[model samples]
Target: MNEKTEELRDIFTNVTDGEETVTESQTATRGSLEKDERTIDERLENVIAQMRERYAFETTLTDEELIRVAKGFYDDVSDEDLASELEVSSEDVFDARLSLHLVESEADAPDIDLAAIRERDAADLDALADEFDASEPQIRRARRVAAAQDESRAANDRYRDEFDSILGDSELTERIASDVREDGLEDATEGMETDVSL
Candidate 1:
């Protein structure tokens, strides 16, 4: 592993106490997009617990709620829905999400002055809405997005790094490119076979 690859490999060390599987596709077929000894929810819960201890957070929500925040974020569940489900206020849900480092949705709209909106999170929402020609809810969402970006920057996104590593498989990709160039067979898919197979 080079410097960057090594840094990614150094992340969270695949559970110090976990099972290892190196099954062959021909021998055993597993169905997850990526096989893991721990399920996603289990891993999310563990990560939340670790974050709580590491950051010395004093959140009142239980372990279940923290896991929900992590899963809910990706599931596209709004803060209002999450708050309703947890029987907590939206602010409490947002705080819990940030506390778990579940923040990282950023707005990149050219029309909105996101920086100004973020800077004045506590400023009058009505004035900001008028200045930006956006609704109060829109400004509020922008503020939340800004907060998520700011908070998520504290650490590298682990799953994204994993995806990058897989997508950047130079060995396999280089071999495929070399074979294609060596064969001098342009348009490999131009007139490929489309017959039935068992």
Candidate 2:
């Protein structure tokens, strides 16, 4: 009976010892996982802080400075070097390069002068159209509008000359001219038909 009691006690002790060992192993693993997670969080926070600093610095640059930095990037400078020099991120340097390229392309485009186009003669306009690789109809339309304006000015000048010529004549002659103009005799004469049947 004493031997049986001792064997039972040893079995109970062994089971408890196995449970304690497993619990300790589990606790150690959990602690290790928590430490790894904390390290990762710290590293991520540090990277985020650095990114914020770079963004703030990049935003402070003027457009001219950005263009200069972009130019330097295109001039074969390394991205890391440019970022260090400009105190901005490599991403910001890439964006500056794109913006500078857009600005330069717009600047390189030719400016159109519609007024100058309107003043050019048909032959000159055709030449211009050929030079600009434009369609003939567009050139013709500009020429037509310019010609119409010219005609209108010439008509105004003729009327002014007529009025001046009449101003130097007698009052009776001026009245006759005025009456003829008001009666539309100039237009009437052009449309009149002569009757030859008697």
Candidate 3:
């Protein structure tokens, strides 16, 4: 076993009082994206629980203290709320505060707009349909599908662009370059098949 695995096993051993022996398989999978391994979040939560016993007596902890505590409890509790309750500064709460705020606020807020959005006029919709020159139902369905496709394409393109940079090595050049040069070939073929099917 590597030093890190040994260290982790040691730490795990120190934390757990139960007669759980650290297996080689367990150490091998630690910090890996394997299904069997405990997630960093789960391991951290366990560690935090062990650590929290030391601070549990404090009625309130400061933002720094809250952050220190929360660093081991990522995505577990509301860091901001804990920070506030602990009398910690907003800046001291971790970098995930923004994401947490967005998520929490979104959850608490109404799903649909409380205020009504103005509906598109019949004439406007008709004009849009006419502009497309397809059957009204077909045009509406196609528009929705096209919008979704555009979003999917954009995401795929972004991932591919990032992948291209990493895959520019000489050994992978031919395959990646050919793939890029013939990009959208499958989609084009699928479109032809779809037209025939329809």
Candidate 4:
């Protein structure tokens, strides 16, 4: 590469070297590197690496099996977390999840009854609070929502973020928008019951 191109590369390295923040002077040049530096594949790989570092929980299962097991463990965890648990790449986790859906479709795996789980979680949390002999209002409130619900709160959060991104404008007047809002309201009331029965 030429001098300018080489200089750009050095700048990118500096930017990603865990610098505090991007300054105004670097913004324009930074944009070019940001646009070109990480491809979808590379970013995805990095995500997988980060995930693996985060969840490394104990499990003897293979990546694919581990993903399935992890899902059963919690409905709210990101596939990245699952990937980490399974000691695999996020892409692998994605593929495994897709396969799970396909198999679920064939087997008619019952859609999770999130409402029931939430109610159960609440009950369990209540019991735990009683058993512990001390109850904080905040703890009671949170427990009431997920006393026994499948650990899918994280998943629900992800979906919420994704939904918001897709919706973009918050101005909701359209019928579809109304429906979406209604669904979200119901979900909230149900305490993260996004894993409804299929």
Q: Best TM-score goes to which candidate?
A: 1
lDDT per residue as tens, model 3, 72-189: 2333556566567656654344322321111222222223221111133434546655654545554443333333334335445442232223222322555565786688677667
Candidate 1 lDDT, 15-120, residue by residue in tens: 4333343345666753333334665557666666666665655367888887676567656788899889999887777777666655544522335676787778
Clashing pairs in 3: 63-88
Query: Between the candidate structures 2 and 4, which one is better when assessed by TM-score?
Result: 4
Question: How well does candidate 1 match the true structure in TM-score terms?
Answer: 0.48
Local accuracy by lDDT, each model? 0.63, 0.48, 0.41, 0.43
What's the TM-score of every candidate structure? 0.48, 0.20, 0.19, 0.25
Per-residue lDDT of model 2, residues 25-46, tens digit only: 4443321212233332243334
Candidate 3 CA-lDDT value: 0.41
RMSD of each: 15.7, 39.0, 23.7, 20.1
Q: What's the lDDT for residue 13 in model 3?
A: 75
Where model 3 places Cα greater than 4 Å from the true spot, the runs are: 1-76, 89-96, 99-108, 111-198
Whole-model lDDT, model 2: 0.48
Tens-digit lDDT string for candidate 4 (49-126): 444454442333344464353334234566577678767786565444432221222122133333443545554756
Question: How do the candidates rank by lDDT, highest first?
Answer: 1, 2, 4, 3
